[model samples]
Target: MSWGIEIYEKGMPIKITGRSFIFDQIAVTQNGSKTYNNIPKGRSLAAYIVARNRGSYFTVKVENNKISWNSLRGSQSINGIIMVLIK
Candidate 1:
């Protein structure tokens, strides 16, 4: 398995490629409440939010070979690490 860190802006798409099996761990920061969509395809081996405030939240999503980050509130920042597995 291989891993990497990715930084993205709200509504941006990040591409991840490698072995056949892959996954991601994402942390996000937003300026307001938000909802995460399209998380990993598996059983969510694990997940959590490290931090949050009254006006901010976090979310993550993974689909196919790409991962897209979004904030329902709009205009937010996101950072996270994706772990890819090959089998």
Candidate 2:
């Protein structure tokens, strides 16, 4: 199994409900009320992006996307399992 992240397109509410499993433990950038998560090795930052601003829609540029992470580290059992629920 590869330690990585996943991205999805679903209703905005679902992202907030499942923010834990989606984000890593290190934020690389922060701007006012918005904080961007660090791009982890083998992990994409898409899921974390949506997880930040829950219940809101935003344009995510894959070439230059942002993320936000939680500073909680543990054993690498599961790195990414982001699920976007459809309404």
Candidate 3:
């Protein structure tokens, strides 16, 4: 908090940290999109990064109360993903 950006939640300070989760070990049909629910609410920004992959690509985004990862190139099956929440 000495330099750069600082975050707060309900008047409490927040750390710029991330959480990671893994994708199911199965086939995701080509050009398909999957939604992950029960994401934490009330944050300034929510973003994601691909952790690992097998043979597909992804375009990840956070919307409303869920996160969606679309197999933009083909059948997307990733090893894991990191969800970063910024307050």
Give the number of the best model, judged by TM-score: 3
Residue-level lDDT of model 3, residues 1-87, one tens digit each, is 233434453466544433322323324333334454544464433544424356546666666544456766555444445444544
Query: Which residue pairs does candidate 1 place in steric collision?
Result: none
Error of 3 at 39 (Å): 7.3
Candidate 3 lands at a TM-score of 0.42
Off by over 4 Å in 3: 1-45, 84-86
Model 1 over residues 1-87: C-alpha lDDT tens digits? Answer: 676533334546343334233434444443322233554455332223433455554454544444444555566654433333322
The weakest ten consecutive residues by lDDT in model 1 span: 43-52
What overall lDDT goes with each candidate model? 0.41, 0.32, 0.46
**What is the lDDT ranking, best to worst?**
3, 1, 2
TM-score of 2: 0.23
Best-first order by TM-score:
3, 1, 2
Cα-based lDDT at residue 8, candidate 2: 48
Backbone clash numbers for all candidates listed:
0, 3, 0
Query: What does the lDDT read for residue 16 in candidate 2?
Result: 32
lDDT per residue for candidate 2 within 53-85, as digits (tens), equals: 332333223332443233233322223222212
Q: Could you give the C-alpha RMSD of every candidate to the true structure, in order shown?
A: 10.9, 13.4, 9.5
As for TM-score, the candidate ahead, 2 or 3, is: 3
Number of residue pairs clashing in candidate 1, backbone atoms closer than 3 angstroms, sequence gap of 3 or more or interchain: 0
